[model samples]
Target: MEHQWVLLFQDAASVREILSHLIYLSFVLKDSPPLFVKLNVAIILEVLRYAQMHQLFPTFSLQTIVFFSLELVRVTTYEEALGQAINLQKSKLFCSRNTLDDLKNLIATTLGVRQVLGTCKYLGLPSMIGHSKHATFKFVKDRIWNKINSWSSRCLSQAGREVLIKSVLQSIPSYVMSIFLLPGSIINEIEKMLNFFWWGHNSANSRGLHWLSWERLSVPKVFGGMGVKGLKAFNMAMVGKHAWKLVSSLESLITRLLKAKYFPRSDYFGASIGHNPSYVWRSIWSAKDVIRRGFQWSIGTGEHIPVWDHPWISNVARILPSTHHHLEWPSITISDLLITPEKQWNMELINTFFDTVTARNIFNTRCFLW
Candidate 1:
């Protein structure tokens, strides 16, 4: 088993080297968009798939015939497709707590890796997030503390500390923040650490007078306060950037995938946090407010824009027109009001359905057919 594992690792390294060369050659040879790049990568990946399938054919076939024979009629393309081979020495297999011991053993032996309980770190963040979001994300707080502790507050002037705090301390959890909404407790604790460090206190035990609140510090320098980012707001903005992408890039693959899974019936703006949502989905959903506040739908086809639900009209004080009076009218799209082919708004229908103010606003807004 050990000899076979070593051979497998060597083979994996050779395959990686081949892939790197291929990728470099592809980039040098083809000047194309991201979609074409992905297609090129897919073609390269087929090499790995075949290599892995060749190596695992006998064992996989036996396993399929024995263990999963009833569960799955045949192995899926996804199962056969190439992925990064696990390093038996460094990699650990994580399974549900309730997973049977026999199944765990089978997986470990098959994969040549050890089984681990609880959770483990992957690329500085938890590979799996269990309940207790605070506990799961507590590492971010610890990381901030460690970085702050390493610095000497007494040696540096307030100016120096400010730069360090902004550049280093605040940026420690940015990658994590971009993906996950840090628990309020973790954010508060991290802010407290930053507050202490900024006020010339070396440690939590040291006392320093806090002349201004962290909020004031977080305010823009143009607003007569130091330009330090508020973690909570910054996190929201970072995650909201991705949410904004979903709104803007309707044809993107990720947008399509998320739409299919989370909000097949409605658009992204109207998506709900459906049952058993993923942490990624929840984090993105949390920032919907950030996107909503700034997002005004530009008139395109208007087929997707809901007249009652969407914020299409910027001329009015409220982006979304008041709907209390028109509750009786069925839900309608902006396109529904248009006389098609000519793509002109049907003033008769608009005047019949909407109040004078709304009808006027609809007419005032321009819609381009092209």
Candidate 2:
């Protein structure tokens, strides 16, 4: 009953073959012969209608579909996949290969795809050159430094400098910070640049003493410090957002990709930092603690929740008293307490297994039953 859409073709002829196979599959699944014939005819008519509405010859549209389909496939071997890309005519490849001369020559002569190196930009974010966190974010520091060097602080008022720092300089690394946990050194460099812009002499070469610490300045308005954004906390919050998305948006493409690559056998809540993970993946994993502190499960059927461990009951201590360690059934779920037909908590069972105070709390706790 499971159906999969495959895109291994570059022309209308391939699409026709696929459609014919689908029609045959439908016929095999349907019991009534007349209905089977009608279903096949309907599918063909719908395909024709789709082609007409899009103003494309049915065969021509196959190339467009093929182009889009490439996004879903992970290209492991560029040379092998190059033939298919060439056949499409509308597609090209930008490759990052190792320094083996034989392999490079083979790719250049046979595949003809454009070769690139570590400097390639993806979605405007530069690729990390190596494992060094500071070097990875050096460009972000350079960018902000250049901007500060270009501006003459002498001509601008204190208020103008503050406005520029908040609006312009702080925003230079906002995009990169969202994905990478920037090094403390890089953050200090950025803060120094901002500090120099705010308190230093107007000349780019002149130095000035900071009247206040960067940490104090980063505090909120209600606090004693200026309300400036701290790079480290902002980076953590941004990465934490991705962790939140992985839990809440299970069907999202990012969630699916991460799940497949990092935690195929387990859920996001139970995922660990596996061996040799990418820097981006490592940064996302680092936010797991933040996500766990804020997460609470609402009681539904509660079949998947552990009674003692899960943070389900609101306004109560998360774990039971250590004195109750002798009690068995550590892995029991809330669903085990429910009466089968009536779907209500078994009071006698609860009383038998728990102390008077514990039993009373369990009986009084509100359950969402979702």
Candidate 3:
């Protein structure tokens, strides 16, 4: 049921709560009925109302395989409300290769659908991913190349080509990039196509002099180059935004769901790539460097930030305290450094464990409780 809802509002936050539950269905179901094409927020909300009234939802643990039997019934309830049924003939049921044949047949028969082997595409992105990531995301490169070749660059001025590249060509893979981190190779290939387009080469085989490297052109115009976005940097920024959300927007359903599985005990910055991590987790984790460099804990009750380990000090080259200043208070939190009740810095205790420079930095660190 994962759909690209265009002609809708620019942000998805308006319907995010209602759609949050639908994430499970993305893993369970590959295609939506024709009715989905015409759906607006109002129609979607109406459908959810019918679903709730009928008690179609079954409680299940997050990140676990959804019991298809229960979800299929929910789909039936949706069909009844929408007056359109799932086209089982055109639809596909993707399952793990390790799935038992008998169970697969039972579920497929129950839903009246065909079981497809290997990974299937849902809205042009792979529904299931494996180790061969580059192969899995080759569609991104192909899509960009196809679009670039189709456009006739012969008649357009350099300015017109710049607009086309900025507006249409770069946006082609944006949706996919937002979800998954495109491989470096694919990003390079896409940039190569864009570079050619910018310099008047319309086809892959055609040659044009690339006067400035893409990195230079991607710099801001103020820095003596075009303000074209660097694909690698842009992809990281897009994925890092999600990582930041997991920290800032704690109560969000997506945050809760991801936290439950990956970082149950630790925050996003501290979370590890656990054994057999999903592609989604890996993609998000890939931006950990970006998050770590930019992340600064806002000291609230000072409960979360570690005194020695975390980056809490602002406007410094190295936010964490230097290893030269060592202490055995591994269990200490930033709260311990505060004179509680007043919530002011404990200057005497700060000087006891830290060097002169380090002590000054600690005093300068802002505390919200104060």
> What lDDT score belongs to each candidate, Candidate 1 first?
0.74, 0.67, 0.74
Ten-residue region with minimum lDDT total, candidate 1: 65-74
Which is superior by TM-score, 2 or 3? 3
What TM-score does candidate 1 reach? 0.75
TM-score of each: 0.75, 0.68, 0.74
**TM-score quality measure for candidate 2:** 0.68
Could you arrange the candidates by TM-score from highest to lowest? 1, 3, 2
Q: Return the lDDT, model 3, position 204.
A: 78
* Residue 40, candidate 3: alpha-carbon lDDT: 34
Candidate RMSDs in Å, in order, are 11.2, 10.9, 13.1
- The positional error of residue 245 in candidate 2, measured at the CA in angstroms, is 1.3
lDDT of 3 by residue, 145-249 (tens): 888778889888989999998999899888988989888888998898899999999887887788999889999999998999899988999888898889789
> Runs in model 2 with CA error above 4 Å?
1-99, 201-205, 317-327, 339-364
> Where does model 3 exceed 4 Å of error?
1-91, 100-102, 323-327
- Name the better of 2 and 3 by lDDT: 3
State the lDDT at 75 in candidate 2. 35
lDDT, residue 19, model 3? 55
